[model samples]
Target: MDPNEPIESADSTPESTTNKPQVPPIPTDGTPKKKYVRAVGPNLKKLLYVVFALLALLGANSGYLASIIAMQWYTGETFENFFYFCMFLGHVALGLLLIVPFIVFGVIHMRNAAGRRNRRAVNVGYALFAVSVAVLISGLLLVRAGGFDLKAPTVRSTVYWIHVACPLVAGWLYWLHRLAGPRIKWKVGISYGTVVGATIVGMV
Candidate 1:
């Protein structure tokens, strides 16, 4: 090659020099990523089941109360005296009424707890119901053994007043129990309803 010849003669050939076409680099840093959505958990399902169970129980209990009132009306019984005796029997029977709803709810929801650990709410509620039943039975037996007539003229008799007052207290406590709830109002309301229902049965 001539000395003055353009240097392009040596490197101007594209294929002989190994020069490569430029390509943009893929982005790896500072890219906005998509968020993954999580699924709902089981505890929430259990809570929902419990709430539903409570609502069902409440309806059942309200019906039971209405029935007692209706029966009294039908019989033309003295509300102040004979009604108390009838309430005594009715409340004891109420205990028996509660078992079905609770069992149905447990099976429907697949709740396996048995009044243990945090399930104390259910356990305590059930226990109170049982106690109420027992109290009703015993009180009735006491009245029967004493040979005291429920239809006696006086409404303020000692035994009569105690029956009314004791039941009234129990009913109020059960209502408070039903109303007690934390962040989950429905859960608490339903769970607590059983207590009130059982108490009503005991008192009635």
Candidate 2:
């Protein structure tokens, strides 16, 4: 009310002027924030088991076919019925149906590894996936090139060899990947045993 006195603003109170903790401003941009949800441990384990089982079956079938081919080449013994049955099982049943789930689960496993920030696992998983994909494509190409026929000219083609070599490389990579993880000694023994067992089973 005094004519010369300074007028106090309503917002100039001590409470208003007191320093409070500054709250971060909420982002207003339209971009959605990324949330890294970890994959479920049990579910991931199940997925891995499924993937490995499928791989084993597929690998065994391929090995059987390869062994038959090698025997025919080395000893001149033909296994037409066995070869046809294996071709049907491997190409039609496993290749068409099981491969889809194999790739899906494999990708899921790789992504899970990436989410866990396991650099080595992610790298190895991705490498294996890529090589497996290459193997699948080459196998399909081999089939198209008449490699399915024992006497077909395409049996001797580069594509057939590529299909063969890709699987060998993939098997090597798989063993390496397994051995690089925990229980190195156990994995090494298992890897060797698996190779030997598969080879023997195929030969028989």
Candidate 3:
């Protein structure tokens, strides 16, 4: 009615009457930042699950070995027995302990990848770990079955040396698993776990 006068705006002409900054639309490319894939590939998923399970089992076993060795070391009189047993068990058990976590982590890494790169070192690590466990267990079982007569000429220091060495090598290989990630940091974690395992086994 008052075209000659300045028109006073209604209480609400439009809520968005003023110009607003427009947000850029998201790109159609499906790639999302830090988007984790479901990792549904049957084979890769199975591998990841199996690897995780093995890590858990191995960790428990290492704990058992460590306990036995520590107990044996506590009861025994001769430091020589303690030393030998501790060294062997500590190395083995600790090595396993160190490795289990990394292996589990590696499985996670693999599954998350939406694709797996070179896993050769990691695979080698698993094999070596299994072999180490078997060797140590067999050696100890042999000694125990023979009435703890590890002092026999046939079961010489060389046998003991091998017992210690098997797991040590495995430990080192497991350490390589850390390299599976971007960089390699050879801190004392796996090495220490191996020592603990060897210590425990030795006591037993």
Candidate 4:
């Protein structure tokens, strides 16, 4: 060592090699924290199925009423005028009820229904839903405009054909929906079956 240089102390140590205080890693970037999102779950999906099937049954009942009018026109038969009016009111109420779950389930499944496997089926389903909604609105409007005259050989009104035809096609579309849709629980299946049987029985 040079004579002018200070001697190093025996206790001197480098501070850089000491164990660092481990920092708890934190996200300091400008991105907003992600909120917790509940996943699309089975129970909710099943409930939607139940609601959809029930809506179809209600729609079927409305169509059956239209058939009664058609038959009266065909056979020169007549129904209780007041009874037809009551049925029309019930159909309107059911249509209003159907609208609620349709919107709610559509929103709930928006993110989950993005697969391509059932695209065609889903497309058909959406079309049927639109037609059904149109039928509901038009039927309500026409009935309000005095559309339910149960004359001999049926007057064949626009709303009558719409109500009848849409349901006829929608029946097959519902079958298509089932063929291409996801597999569900037996309970859901049972409920759907029950509603469908009831709808058919009503028509008969």
Best candidate (score: TM-score)? 2
RMSD of 1: 15.7
Across 55-107, the per-residue lDDT of candidate 3 in tens digits comes to 44455454555465566688874334555565456545544454555455445
Q: Which stretches of candidate 3 lie over 4 Å from their true place?
A: 1-116, 142-152, 155-158, 182-204
lDDT of 2 by residue, 105-161 (tens): 777766656755556766776787788888777666555444454455665477667
CA deviation > 4 Å runs, candidate 2: 1-40, 82-91, 115-118, 144-156, 184-204
Q: If both were scored by lDDT, which would come out higher, candidate 3 or candidate 4? A: 4
Q: Rate the local accuracy (lDDT) of all candidates.
A: 0.51, 0.67, 0.56, 0.64
Give the TM-score (vs. native) of candidate 1: 0.27
Model 2 residue 16 lDDT score: 50
Pitting candidate 1 against candidate 2, the one with the higher lDDT is 2
Instruction: Write one digit per residue (lDDT tens) for candidate 4, span 17-46.
Output: 456676787778968776543324676677
Error of 1 at 52 (Å): 15
lDDT of residue 151 for candidate 2:
50
Displacement of residue 196 (Cα, Å) in model 3 is 9.3
- Residue 16, model 1, lDDT: 38
Consecutive 10-residue window with the lowest summed lDDT within model 2: 142-151
Compared with the true structure, what per-residue lDDT tens digits does model 1 show for residues 1-204?
A: 899875657536676346777678867897866553212137645654654564455445544555566678999864445755554555445544544554554443324434225454555455545444444444454344356645544642555445444545555545554543234466766766677677657755
**After aligning candidate 4 to the native by TM-score, how far in Å is the CA of 19 from where it should be?**
36
Per-model TM-score, in order, reads: 0.27, 0.60, 0.34, 0.54
Q: lDDT for model 1, please.
A: 0.51
